[model samples]
Target: MTRTDGRLQVALVALCAAVFLDSMDLSLMGVALPAIGRDLSLPESTLQWLMSGYAVAYGGFLLLGGRIADLFGRRRVFLLSLAGATGYTAGLIASGLLTEISWRLVFFLPVPIALLVLAAAPLVLPRGVRPPGAREGFDAVGAVAVTGGVLLLVFALTEKSWPAGVVAVLLLGAFVVIERRRSAPLVPLEVFRSGTVGAANLAALAWACATIGWQFVAVLYLQQVLDYTPLTTGLGIVPMGLAIVITANLAGRLISRYGLGRVAAAGMLIQGAGILLFLRAGATGDYLTVLLPALVVHGIGNGLSFPSLNIAAVAGLPDERQGLASGLVTSAVQIGAGIGVAVLASMMTLGGSTLAGYRIAFLMAGGFSLIGALAAAFGLRPRRPAPVPAPTV
Candidate 1:
C-alpha cells in the first residue's frame, strides 16, 4: 500500500478510537452512577445531571464548534475535541472493575489515552487544502445565546425551575433573532430548506431521546431494582454493545439496498419494539429471558438507525455546508439526550412503586422511538430512480 493510504488508515483508526472513547464514556457513566451516588450520598435527580450536563454542553456548543472548524482548520478543531473524550469498548468492564475500588478512577480512565491520541494526531491528521482568511465573521452572540439557552433549559427541566425555563426561552428567542441578522451565523436557517436535513435531524433527536433515556432507566433498574452489582450490570450490557458493533458493520450495505428512509424507519420501529419489551421487567425479572433479548434487539435497531440518521442529515447538502449539517445533527442528538434523561428522571419520580416508575419511563422511551420512526418514514424525501441507458449494442 502507498504511504498516503497508510496515513489515511491511521487517521481513520484515530478518529474511530476517539468516537469509541466518547461512546464508551457515556455507557461507563451509566454503569458507574449508582456507585458514585452511594459513595457521595447523592440522589437520582443529582445523578442524572452527570449525563445530562455533558449532553447539554456538547449539544449547545457543537454549532459553534462546527463554525470554528470552518473558520480555523478541521484537523485542529478535531484534535482539540479529542482531548475531552474518554473510554472505549472495554470501558464497561473497566468501569465495573474501577468502581469496585473507587469511582474516581473511572472518571480518570481517558486522561492518558486522550493524551496519547493528541500526541499522535498532529502526525496523522491531514492539514486543510486552503488557509482561512483574516476576516472571520463568527456569530459570538448567537453562539452564547444558544448555548446559554440550552443550558438553562436543561436546568429548568431537571430542577423544575420555572424562572430558569423562562430565561432559557428568552435567550433562545434572542439567539434566533441574532442568527437572522448575523452575516455568518452559527447555523444558517436556510439549511432547513432541504426537507431531508430537517427530517433527519428530527429523527435523530427522537432516536437519541428514546435510546439515551432507556439506557439511563435500564441501568438504574439493574442496580437499584434488581440488586445487581456493577460488574454484573456491565457484563449484562456488553451484549447490546456487541450487537451494535456487529449490526453497524452491516448497516452501510443494508442502506445501499433498501435506501436510507426504509432502513432508518425500520430500525426505529425495531428499536421501539425492543424498548417496549423492557416494560415486562420487574424486581424479579430474569436477565436471560427478559433483559438479554430486549437489549440485543435494541442494539441491532440502534446500529441500523444511528448511521442512517447521520448520513441522511448530510446527504443532499453542498460540500461547504457539510460540517454545519454534521454539527446540527449531533447537536440535535445531544439536546434530545438531555431532554430525554431529564424527562425520564421526572417520570421515575411518579407512580407508587419504583418498578412502576421504571415501566412508565420505558413506555415513554418507546413512544419517542415511534415518533422517530414516523419522522424517518414520512419526512425524508424518497430517492428518484436513475435514468435507464439506451440499448446501443
Candidate 2:
C-alpha cells in the first residue's frame, strides 16, 4: 500500500529466502553425508562432526551476531550475511559436483555463509528506527568466552575428549561471570527472568535436539540400512520438507487463533508421536510403511512449533532488546542441535546393533519432544489483544 509497507514486504521476502536457502543446505548435507563419507573415506565418528561443528559455531556466535545486528543495524548485518552465505553455497555446489574431494569441504560449507552475513555490513537494507546507543553496550570478553566455551564443548563431545570438556566448562563459567559484571551485557541476564522467554528458548532447544538428532539417524538409516543411493535418499525426504513448508504457512494463522502455547504444545506432541512411529521400523522396513508417515508427522510438528516458539520468544520484548531475544532463541536452536547429534550418535554407535541403536535414538528423540511439549504448555503465555483508542469527537 505504502512505500514503507512495500519495503518491509521486500525485506521479509529476502529474509525468508535466505532462511530457505540455509534450510535447503542443511537438508541436502544430511542426505549427502553417506555419499561424502564413502567418497572421502571418512569414519562415522568424524562424520558426526560435520553437523556438530556447524552447530557449535552457529550457536556460539548467535548472541554475538544478534548483538552486532543491534549495534550495527540488523539490515546491514542481514545483507552482509546473505552475501557471504551465497558465496559459500556456490563453493559447496562446486565441491559437491567434483568427483574427488575431501570431507573437510563439508565442514567448511557453512563458514562462507557465516562470513557472508558478517560481511553484509555495507549492503542496503530497509530503513527502520534504530535502537539508541546500541553500539556502546558490546561485550567483547563475554563474546570470546562464550564462543570458545561452546566450540570446545562441542569438540569434546564429538571427539570424546574430557580435557577439552573441562576447559569448555571453565570458559563458560568465565562467561557467566563476565556477563554478570558487564553494564550492558551481550545477553541481559534479566531476560531469563521472564518465564515465557526462558520456556520458549528451552522448548526451542529441546525441539532442535530431537529433530536434528532424528534427522541424523534417519538419513543414515535410509542410506546404510535401506541401501538407498544419495539421490534417492534426498528425493525420499522431499515430502517431509514440503510438509514442513506447507504447515509452516498454516501455523501462523493457527497461532493467531489458538495462541502460541497451545499451538506449540500441540505441535510438539504431534511431532513426538511421529517420531514414536519410527520405533516399529527395523532393518527390513520399507519407506512407505516405516519412514513416510513419521516424516510427514514430524514435518507438521516442525512447521507448527518453530514459528510459535519464535513468536513466544520475542512477544513482549522492547524493540531495543529484540536482537538479543532473537539471538538467544537461535543460540538455543544451535546448541540443542549440537548436543542432540553428539548424544544420539553416541547412543547409536554404543548400542549392540545398528538397528537397535537407531531405535534407541528415535525413542530418545520422541522423549525429548514430549518433554518440550510439556515445557511449552507450562511456560508460555497467550498474547493479549491491543486496546482500541476512542474515536475523537
Q: TM-score, each model?
A: 0.91, 0.87
| TM-score, candidate number 2 | 0.87
| Off by more than 4 A, model 1 | 83-101, 130-134, 383-393
- Tens-digit lDDT track of model 1 for 1-393: 999999889888877777666676778888999998998899999999989888878888888887777777788888877754434424544665754767766666666667777787789998975435216567777878988898888789888999999999999999989888877788889888888999999999999899998889899999998999999999998998899889999999999998898899999999998999998888899999999999999999999999999999988588766667888988999888888898889889889988889999999999999999999998775867799999998
List of clashing residue pairs for candidate 1: none
Superposed on all Cα atoms, model 2 deviates from the true structure by an RMSD in Å of: 4.7
Tell me how many clashing residue pairs each candidate has: 0, 7
Task: Tell me the spans in candidate 2 whose CA falls farther than 4 Å from its real position.
Answer: 1-5, 87-124, 382-393
lDDT of each: 0.86, 0.81
The digit string of per-residue lDDT tens for model 2 on 130-189 reads 667675868878888987898788778777899999999999999999889888788878
The stretch of ten residues in a row with the least summed lDDT in candidate 2 is: 115-124
| Residue 145 miss distance in model 1 (angstroms) | 1.5
